[model samples]
Target: MLKTALFGLAAATQAIALATIQAKGSKLFTSDGNQFYIKGIAYQLTEDDPLAQGDQCKLDATLMKTLGANSIRVYHVDPTADHDACMSAFSDAGIYAWIDVDTFSTYILPDNPEWNETMYDAYASVIDAFHNYDNVAGFYVGNEVLTTGASSIAAPYVKAAARDMKAYRDSKGYRSIPVGYSAADIADLRPNLQNYLACGSNSSESLDFFALNAYEWCGQSDFETSGYTFLQQNASDYNIPIYFSETGCNTPKPRTFDDQAAILGSDMADSWSGAIIYEWIQEANDYGLISYGPSAAATATNAVGGYTRSGTPTPISPDFDNLSNHWKTLTPSGVSMSAYNPSASAPSCPAFTSGNWLVSGNVPLPTLGDAFKASGSSSGSSSGTSSGTVSASPSSSRAGTGGSSASAAPSSTGEAAAATSSAAAMRNGVPVIAQWAVWLGGR
Candidate 1:
């Protein structure tokens, strides 16, 4: 017993020594101040409770290390769980976490997002849950909340939430945890949303970085053809960091994952940071790079808009090996962190023009509501509910809209052919269409 305690103590000490990451200008830096790039994967164990699954995380972390991953992004976290064990497990394994603070249903509905005290309380609770972990890289205020042109109204509220989170962190005297947003890759509105988020100069109103769930690069594509060139040109003068919050195209089976090269390569390194793959475990969506456990599940079903597995020991897909090989050869930029101009002012907000999707050049940000002032805690008091067990159902990779039954995404593979197809047909299974389908359904 004494020997076990000693070993645990040593492990804790080592975990505590991991470097904390911070954002300076458009780049990330380690505590020792080396430039950091994200080589990550989306990890959501919806079937298991994250709070009670430290062992599972250890199991996951071991494989992540083998894949040469440096980070992991988890979309929904149960704010009530004690994340120290799992967080420590990742830290010890040299993996960082970029977590989202909101939930799939109640917290911040995209169509009618409210930056109220209740939302603030929830955000604060999430911060308290992971703030102590050295490897907690950053927090995403919202994910694809502002995916479509209609959802543009949610922008101000998203910024408000980010502002409040920053203020909350300062009030509690915590490290400057980067707060940002993850947008959907809506071709028409993509540039406008990124510009708007990075326009405000007030630290409270501005985003630390911007991310887009881009899947434009399909099978055998190049930068210009994939629309990355246009993306770089549009965001050329933005003040905050930008990256692919979620990427990895799924239309072509046995995905070669060629985008990994351009994303982490020298050509686009100036304009983008590293990207996180869409997912780690296979689900009904058919996006996962591996199965849940060590061995292949015997009966994997592809119903319910995603693939479901039934059996012990999940299997790793060929995509994993394809991606791992790419990761092994890919070299992240070693740009000096000191080269960034921290005192630089932000670009002016894009003006609201007729026919364009941008809102007023200077939209007023929401203030922290009074409801939270009377009932919340930024003075280091515990905030989120501490449910010691897994309470919610497993979430689908494709999140449903808040209140509506929507259209389907584009369902075919041939791009030009699909584009010319009926809008209804286009809405069947295409990711872009899927995004709109979800929004349309909720409406």
Candidate 2:
């Protein structure tokens, strides 16, 4: 314990007094005083996808660099995914990484240190493996770790783990990297964050800044994720800065890329320091602005940075229309990460037009744990500002509209393709508008 405490002390000194938090309304400052603006995509690092693994990686990275993309949110890694190749591509391309915590569906209890230990060991191993990379922004601890609202116990493990991980990184004398889990928004993560921070009287001490995956799906209204406005208003209590680990949105509403953007674009403008879209290739369903060449649904060969208007969106040979029209609502400059005050209390959102989205029979209120699984996903939090989010991870990804569901993500080759195909087919599986997917061509 003395060793752990000492280690913690040393680690704290390294990052303390440095004060760089990316909360709503605050500039996104890194531990190194670096101010960042994210413009990228959430793509797989699998060998099958030319954008990530093999020779295609060169093509993929080149396209991103050409287009203006500065980062790639790496998720779902396979054994043959070419880890070094992917990271190298991002690094050489000058792209940041919205790295995830391996797979998802984590709900380890604090008392279950054995379980916690096992998971943390693996989690730490990944962090250790990548922390040294300059391009890496930080670690995204869990993907909807509390989706089910089913964990009878609110584990303070995350807070404890954050401290332990920091110590582990520092004992060996390493620079501090931002670290935290990714929830769609604070409402989904409230349980975990609150419990994690409540570990001791000095709760905030355990974790670094918080991270959010603020992807607003279609049928959504003018709203930021639920707690962002609250956080902005109460920035003093939740002083921890927030890095948008992921913020994606589908476009064109029902068809291809609709010229109309979400009404919440203002919320994004005024509420974040860093955020990235989830795609680049203009594929079917208005997800990617360009296609990966082999998409069975789209074949419209659009130039790197093609359309900038609302007219017939150059289709990307997509298979389904499971997307929301978000790109249509940019602040004109596109990809705005500057901070602003929360809206004058957000009004009721479209998703929540109906009372409570979650079907009480399936998912009870005051969601306990399992941050990634919502049976009948709901929208809006009656507490003034409206914010509702859905979680997607390698283990299980959920869709928010009416019928939210979860499925284990594939980790191997054949299986991964199936997941990808299924995701493309289901259309509903579209990730929240990840604001970081724009495929960049130039600096």
Candidate 3:
């Protein structure tokens, strides 16, 4: 008991003092009641734990500060690994983290989706791991889970993931860290997906926020020409905070990032929170603002495999300067939370349409122990292989959770068995039960 108490004290001391960002009626607010905007960049390099390397995180956090970024969206992280170094580094730099709870093996795939016990436990573990951090802005239950309209059948499972994650956060007595989803911005699935996630009467089940991976604004494009006008119009009355989970088109070279001006300017800042650029590293996608190694060694193919992520960082030419210039000039001071009154009501859930939207608004979202199976198998019972417990060691070869991975085998008895196994798993040499007790002691 004394050892656990000391551990809790150390954890508390390591936590940096960053204001918790909260979602309140179509806007985000800081602890002091000021409207918070997410001027962030996606910060995932390798498939494994990006934040595990403390030195690398410090390097990136320093550069991100120069770019005037206040938040970062990490696509994947190992829940078991100690994130104190990276989390503290970012927090000390006044940066917040919007972490995705799902992993390569644990996410809900669009074509073959499931809201099983393994997924639930994976999401829950992530929440438990980062809930203690003061700079954790939010957690994304899944990213681009439903890409095309044909795969919209998976909407219930996505919603269920959010519901269960939120419930798990509450059950653990953790701060109300926003749990939300990031969509792929499909035209046919437009307002339907957005409205469906935020519509339901049960606020507990509804998403705390919604994010879109929008890249409609190409080089030198205006709000209307880029289709942002339509997007702002569609989401004008949304009840929850919304922003771009991913953006920055690189097709026309140089990548001006004109959308930055529009997103932070008067046109959309009132309606939208803020946007996170596509990514930080100079990857194969060519959207990176900074490369890892020497300019000569940076290859256009498989940047993750080719570049050296360690030593001094190198800025990716005019692209980096362009984003910096935009951020330096555009500053949006949102309304104070104290004087702000939320009048927008939750939008009605979109009615199901064949081939476009499959999940009917009338049907209840898939429940873990009810309509949704624990194994995500067609059969009612699982095969006992799907424990949903993440390996104690993080996998380096695995792909990012934002993309698809081979599905796990089915499980038996679903939620109960998986939860029991998860609770038994060791974290930082302490059982989850004991760790929770320690966390509670700190509070």
Candidate 4:
């Protein structure tokens, strides 16, 4: 029998074909081939249960529409639930969704970063659950995995999972659903990470897009003053689309959301796709653009990670009003994929710069770990072939001709082992992200 999600998709597709967004150069395009920009908010719920919040989602959809939100990014979802009603609410309100596949229990933490079949299966389930929904914009392969320079070793495994998932989608004949990563604001290594992910033409190995969870811009800041100029300059030559997966600084209690003007304005439009505000509901960290009120406190225990709420839902913070007012006059650009140069080669891979940890920019990344092989081979699974045939560099092409795709499997003789790196311990210089860990846990 068709599942609720599949049935709803079939019905919805027939009634009104929604545009599935695709990455094109530094921008995004829709099914009708129109250009689109994200004016979204990061949203989960005061109550953590995605399956049971259909009614609540519907209610929130109305508020989001009122705030002029065109999209929402959800950190996690229950694959087993019937999300038709909630998804429908968002769709009806003309809102799109970009979702995360990993959660706290089943995540690729830096301390013990290992990508195996178990992880693959869980991620695949997320794709399976949401692939049918037209309004579902994309999937985040991993959120802020490379939170520090030492975490660079996990890059290959994360890239491997992305390669495999894209292949699975292709195998099932799905559209070009953008699969990307959400990076933390580790300025020192941000450029290298972005360049590395987009270094190869083997589309399977490269992320379709890239996002940054940035909080640099606070009250009353401009492009140059806020360090956005540097970000713009650094990404000037990048081949893939990039945007703020999460933004909206929260230094002052009532965030004015002043960054919205510059983010949605003409200054950074060409270089950036757009932005998704940090959050919807207030949490202990207080980054929310809106407050659900103290009555929603009962759900706070499950909503946020670190801080416990003692008071009733505070009145909608002034940030929401500022955000709403700003969005009222904001006019996003139309979708255009024409500038996309399909023949353009990807950026050359960065040389392994010896940061506090070793980094390998080699392409045809290490094969699917031995643990994930269907045949139980000690090597990568044969099913994990890259979509593009070309290698990112001449040396990479000549270097033992690794995997079937650009993600070459390690040679039996250890000839191509240099292409792989080992995980590093979480030592000093690793940013203190207790709040981030807690927030991700609940999501």
Candidate 3: lDDT of 380? 34
- Candidate 3 residue-wise lDDT at 389: 26
Cα misplacement distance, residue 177 of candidate 3 (Å) = 0.6
TM-score: model 4 vs. ground truth = 0.76
How much is the lDDT of residue 25 in candidate 3? Answer: 92
Which structure among the candidates has the greatest lDDT?
3
Query: Please, what are the lDDT tens digits per residue for candidate 2 over residues 1-443?
Result: 00011344364211112222232223344434445555556554231232234455666676566556666766533323325555666567766665654432232321111123334555566666565455666565544444433321222334445556666667767556666655534354343343343223342334555655554332343334423455344332343444455444443243332212322244443334445554544422234545544333223332222322112223343312222223322433322244333332211111211221211111111211112222233521111110222223221121111111132111111112111001101124432321111111121
- The lDDT for every candidate, in the order shown, is 0.63, 0.38, 0.71, 0.63
Better of 1 and 4 by TM-score: 1
Question: Which consecutive 10 residues in model 3 have the weakest lDDT in total?
Answer: 434-443
Per-residue lDDT of 317 in model 4: 53
Please, what are the lDDT tens digits per residue for candidate 3 over residues 306-379? 55545566888899999999999988889999899999998887776756776667356765532223232454
Question: For residues 144-254, what per-residue lDDT tens digits would candidate 1 score against the true structure?
Answer: 665556656557767778888988998999889899987777776777778788877577788888987777787788888978788778656667778877787776677
Name the best candidate (by TM-score). 3
Better of 1 and 3 by lDDT: 3
For model 3, what is the alpha-carbon lDDT of residue 284?
Answer: 41
Ranking by TM-score: 3, 1, 4, 2
Per-residue lDDT of model 4, residues 1-443, tens digit only: 01243454364333335677888876788867777878898775522334246676777788888888989988767777777777878888888999888643445544334555556777888888888778889988876666555566556656777888888888888777899887766777677888888877577688889888777776777788988888888766677888888777766556777777777777766667788987776554455555555333334553333333222233375777788898887776644566455444578766665552334456345443421221223432222221211221111111211211111111111012122222221225442111101001111
